[model samples]
Target: MSVASEILTALRSEEHDPVRLLRSASNLLGDEIAVMSSFGAESALLLAFVAEAAPDMRVLFLETGKHFPETLAYRSELARFLGLTNVQDIKPYLAQVKDRDPTGELWAFDPDACCQLRKVEPLDAATLSFPVLVTGRKRGQASTRAALPVVEEKPDGQVRLNPLASWSADEITDEMKRRGLPPHPLVSKGYPSIGCAPCTRPVGENQDARSGRWAGLSKTECGIHTAS
Candidate 1:
């Protein structure tokens, strides 16, 4: 097996132990490992594990200028609250944005292209030197992610560590409470799944957590997770 595939197989052995999964990444990749956090609802749960596993692990936050004020504030608040010192905000290049989305309306016509411009491109650039990316995605969040594995081998060979892939929403909520972690400000307002402000909305309690992310559109993922 390739290095990525071997790592994925090894990580699959402990899908239920997020801390161990994170520690494995820390032990194996050290500084080459980084995490991608949305700082949305349920974020505090995974972040708590990251804190326990590797307090200094680099956490990448896509500062996709379109985020809600609350999300941005939550990003800062949660990172401080968790004692995570390596959180970095990745932003799109000014020239690219000026040329492709100068009017800031790319999300109105083609969210996929907009995501590529604002999120995917920036993350690709930021993570160039890193080989593994830890994520907070869980299977219960949405249908698209229902089959997400604990570790994934991307098309480009970077491994994605999803320590919470098997965790339920209730499990996350309970863990947050158990750890005394604060919820994202928007969660109380009903945004169970939060993303960029323009694309995210509040969903009914019965709906999938991610139903609010791209409401009327068929788009589910923002492109970063699935992109090569």
Candidate 2:
């Protein structure tokens, strides 16, 4: 079997233990792993795990330059609060942005292409050296993510390690509160799932956590998680 399959099979036994799962991956991958975080509502929980298991593990954040001022500030605050020393901001190439999104109106016309220019390409470059990537995505976040697994290899050969894959929204919130983790300021205003400012909005209490993201559009993911 491949390395990805072996890790998945090994992680199956520790599915319920997020911390241990994180540690196991860290032990196995060592410096070859990094975490991708949006620093959204429930991000603190996963960040806490990173701080515990491997404080120096690189955390990649897509600095799409379209985020709300609050999100940018919260990103810095949360990283400092968690003592995450290596939170790196991945930004798109200026020439690419200028050529593809001159007026920055690509999001209005084609969000998929916009995401590819901004998020996907930058992340692909940022994570090229790392064989494994850790994410905070959970199964309960959205319909598209309902079948998410703790460990899975993407078609691009990147192994995504979702330690919180089985965690529910409530469980995430509860744990964050218990740990006294600071929340993303927008969460209180109903923005449960925060992303780029243009694409994210506030949702109702009954809506799925990710409903606010790319609201009213058929688009669910930003094309980062999907294979290229």
Candidate 3:
């Protein structure tokens, strides 16, 4: 089998263990692999894993400009900690933002539009430079992602790799501790899941892990990684 085929085969064979799956995928791709991280909750652990597993791998951190200050700081610190040499700070068009909302308040009245311009557009632009993108998504995180596959084809035919597709919340937390990694600063403050500041909130007691995102809305998946 071709090397790519082998990587896909091995990734598909597992459904619940993110660390082993990701480590295998990283070895198969090596310098060709790139991980997409927000440096949010659970992200530090994944990054640390990558650093040790494949120190030469590149990391893509999309800077939506509207991210929480903590997220931005964490991204920088993680890169320094990991000694990632080829980290890329992908970002949206600043000219477009200034043209539409000079004050950058677009996220207030029109969050979806803001996300498209700041998060989605920037990420799409960055994705074209790589053939594979690894993510930290897991099936148990929400209703929409319950059927997540370890290997899938993006609508654009770009290879979508989800190494953590089957991990449970407890398992992830345990792994983080096992690896001696720290959680995102906002995690303990009730932000079980996070995104743009305007849409994310503290999760309630009975809420699922993703409830903090777009709290009142029925929305779940961020458009950047969606197949549709």
TM-score quality measure for candidate 2: 0.94
- Across residues 60-153, which tens digit of lDDT does each residue of candidate 3 receive? 8888777899888878877887777678888888788788768888877776777788888888777765667888787888888899887776
How would you order the candidates by lDDT, starting with the best?
Answer: 1, 2, 3
User: What pairs collide in candidate 2?
Assistant: none
Looking at model 1, which ten-residue stretch has the lowest summed lDDT? 1-10
**Tens-place lDDT digits, model 1, residues 1-228:** 134566667677866789998888788777989999988888898899999999999999999899999989889988898899899999999999999999999999999999999999999899888878899998898888888988787777778889888889988888899889999888889999889988988999699888998899999998888777
Tell me the lDDT of candidate 3: 0.76
Model 1 residue 51 lDDT score? 94
Clashes of 2: 0
Per-model tally of clashing residue pairs: 0, 0, 0
Task: At residue 122, give the lDDT of candidate 1.
Answer: 94
